[model samples]
Target: MDKGKNKWAVLVGCNYPNTKYTLHGCINDVQAMRDLLVKKFGFDPKNINLLTDKPGSFILPTGANIMKALNRIVDQAQSGDVLYFHYSGHGTLIDKPFLPFSKEEAIVPIDFNLITNVDFRHLVNKLPKGVTFTVLSDSCHSGGLIDKEKEQIGPSNNHLHGDSSISCSKPKAIPYESVLTHLSSLSNINTTDIGTHLLEVFGADASLRFRLPHVELEFYKALKQDEGILLSGCQADETSADVISEKGEAFGAFSNAVQQVFKENSGPLTNAEVVSIARKILANQQFEQHPCLYCSDENAAATFLPQSATAASSST
Candidate 1:
């Protein structure tokens, strides 16, 4: 932790109530994380922006609303600032039409609109040097949420439970049928291949297309030279569980494991250790999902959270 650094966080949870894809644990996951950040991590309540689908909440976790909140966080960020983005929701992949078998990962909002990995890369590129944006995504196909960041701990390097096929090692989009069903009716489009239909309408370059509302072509094309750390819930091709714990409380499996690990471990843990521990915790609980850590090797060895040394020490 850097003493002089400012800490900010934007947490989003979308349960998508009344919809067919409604999740049972997303809102609970965010609430738990908010409590951990405030109590254990020394984050200012005022500096944290929470977006959820809960009634009477200040903001809904729609794609446009999420982008607005994220932009505000990025705009106020300066050098030495520690920024956090935690999202517990549905995640999916969009297939690239031009690139054979290429897929782009995306996080689904309450309104069925998606915030794709290209958009995340665009956001990461805007961070000032020395500013760290640590994102924890508890969603399916979230292993590569940060676009081009290196994978420090994943299936390739992890042999947990003798399972080497747990990770996809690449971006895996949700099936087109799932997307089409969630999107509900795609107007007059009768084809079952939604990916092809999307490419035909939105072009091969998803980041450059304005076919969807609240999406800006040039805005998503912005790229920076920096990278961030991502703690994903599962591998690119696996589905994260939103299970009811033994205590009868619903929570995302990865989110629960992370909070539990930090709560139980009083000593400092590296990003690699954190991911490994979380993976084992999930495996022991009979979960098929494998938590992953994505970042540069140097960042992987850095402390788990970007707090000041004193603050980090105090928490432990």
Candidate 2:
């Protein structure tokens, strides 16, 4: 099938407001991306869908908001449509018995909620084959949030534990202390609340003290790889930064770099090209950011993954 000259780009960037424990720059990034997609990527404004924190939390995605829109937008997906999904905010991973959650398993909001990886999988499953599923996550513990963290102690569990990495085989368990430590640092995140939940899932093990861990993203399943991509600002081994410049203005290092790359580069870039340039811009901040690129285009649609993620490989 031939591609649509007017591809769709869905961007979600949030900027937390009225509080310190919120993400304040993602909202700007989402809007900026929306503009770039329209002006540079040939995306029609109508095809672009943007979501943010509800009731003016101003910057965050609640589980309800994500679920509500999942079906509506997915149903509209057509062959050759490019579904661009970008999330900039908080993220986490679960360790132990972590099967990806069904839609009901997680709640998402400024109030602190759960969102399992299956929610995302379900969204992908609903799309017509050959549509581009691009996602960018800026949250610290985001990897596990996309995958289901299972409780290790099962069948009359005493403590709670779950892991969120999904692969062809059953997912391996991630450690509890690792995921929780990331949660504790969030401005409004309560260590007790995160710990309590982990305890419920894994069962309290006095022998097992909690340790902090970074989130990790599993590669896409081959069956689901009709043509999708994921670009992370950095690897799980590194810390994703909140940019506080000498001017005292704060933003996500990842998001800021994205804006810079587009602002500096001319014309539409390929997926590899975009990732390459974004990598450079991010490195300048000393954040050790790395732009990731994943493509599921059997027809080689990855070559057409918006010239954003595949920047270096293409010529503008």
Candidate 3:
């Protein structure tokens, strides 16, 4: 652990207000996580960058804005610093026709500009070797959020096809009504069978070939060697629950479970331990989705928030 290293966090939550996909808990989830980071993990409040869909918020979680924020995080990060990204929103899977039977998982921003697993892979690959990137995604189809990372704690991969790390059935989808609402809000977008058009135009192998022209083919070919820890809300085929808790507060089931688990445990927990306990908590609450952990085998046993948890536990 780097004693003088800084801690930076980018917390994003999209509720998609006024649309058919309006969620009640995304913003709240990020807020709760922000608080936890500051209070428990020793993250400096000023270093935390928050992007949310609440009206008049400083920044909105649009795809471009998100990319910019991520770039800033990576650019300013020093080796040994801890970078954390938390996103609570809708997730989807888009087919990559270039690769036969390949579907990329994506996080939906407020403006509907999709941020795919490829983008995340690019970001993670750019991180300094010693820096740790932790991503917590509380969204549907959130498994494999970091792209090509090994699943340290998840379902058996024997059922997964091809290079997919998570064992999942057919990917679930957002409601068509939500898709219509989003498309209709865009200027000059013809809403007539726009979904079909998206599949035909964006789904083709041609566009993907040009998507990242700056990067060499080898960049996409190689799996990332940097440390990236992903805690996903559910398997690729499952829908995450966004329900109100018994106390009348709304939150994503997996996010809430993680919070509760973290609050209860004071010892230094590994990634595998945290995921295991969080999964049990969600299951006890009757959530259908199962939380997953993805990282290298060594990191699976590393202390969660390595510096913070270790220091705290040693002090006790």
Candidate 4:
């Protein structure tokens, strides 16, 4: 868990599953991401791992398969090693409150069933201290993942759904801290950050019993300085994404935006650049999908590798 030491990563993207839950760009985009990490970021193939549901001559893994793969890496995760978690697929909210959950947990995965807020708390709590974690979620929502029901936009500026035209002016950037402030005002019990607050909106426990639940999370605080970052495609008030890109590939604008950034940047780029690039791509994107990024580290950055070069390296 030394920040000055070397780093490692685990990549997961699911697409073309035998089941209907499969998505369009999860697999392809992750593959692209892995490539960028390797050839560009200089990650050792032996050190970097890839997980997906697709079964071919690649490092792809399935849902259950990915769980097993997680078993192999989580224990070895030391501090300072960057752990980047990415998911590109359908995301919905489970309205059933019967599923028990705890405060320190949340289930943010691709295919989740019988997954409770407590379930999430258990998984993240195991991360090694100081091991930087970056989670990117590009799916339908309520955390609040799903909208529960479809929303019809009205033409009025005040209407937000469909024809309910929202503010005609360009959506301005709201400070991340401000959103956190708004989120904080909503809950009075165990005060927490944006991630914790969002999870609590529909947090597993409804009674709000214990002020602090004893979940075994590495506690983002323990590794707050290990370069941890989170880039959400949308805000707590908005849906993530669902769209196809210019390549005719069905993908969330976020995932496509990620892939596009990897393609253009030949060298190391700051997180700000990545966010800016993704935002620009979304603006011109065929659909209304607008990708976004969130960060805790002001100086964190990523380098990308081209597709052909990455594939060739993986093949060897």
Using lDDT as the measure, the top candidate is 1
Model 1 clash pairs? 1-307, 1-308, 1-309, 2-308, 93-173, 93-174, 125-224
Candidate 2's residue-wise lDDT over 34-99, tens digit each? 776666666668877778763545434654455455556667777767666667665544433334
Global local distance difference test of model 3:
0.72
Per-residue alpha-carbon lDDT of candidate 3 for residues 22-102, written as tens digits (9 for 90 to 100): 787889989998887776777779989999999899878987788778878888888888888999888876655456566
Question: Which of 1 and 4 is the better model by TM-score?
Answer: 1
**What digit string (tens of lDDT, one per residue) describes model 1 on residues 159-270?**
3454222221212234556876644464346765454344444353333222444345445543443548899998875778777655567778888889889888876677
Error of 3 at 254 (Å): 0.8
Which residue window of length 10 is worst by lDDT in model 4?
A: 146-155
Q: What is the C-alpha lDDT of each candidate?
A: 0.73, 0.50, 0.72, 0.46
Q: Candidate 4, residues 63-178: lDDT per residue as tens digits?
A: 34444454455567775555555665544333232234522112233333112233323334566765555555565442321111111111111212222112221111223344
Candidate 1: regions farther than 4 A off: 1-4, 156-174, 181-225, 309-316
Ranking by TM-score: 1, 3, 2, 4
Point out the higher-scoring one by lDDT: 1 or 3.
Answer: 1
Reference-based lDDT, residue 215, model 2: 31
Of 1 and 4, the candidate ranking higher by lDDT = 1
Candidate 1 vs 2: which has more TM-score: 1
Off by over 4 Å in 2: 18-20, 54-60, 98-108, 142-224, 297-316
Lowest lDDT 10-residue stretch of candidate 2: 164-173
Lowest lDDT sum, 10 consecutive residues, model 3, at 161-170
Clashes of each: 7, 59, 0, 25
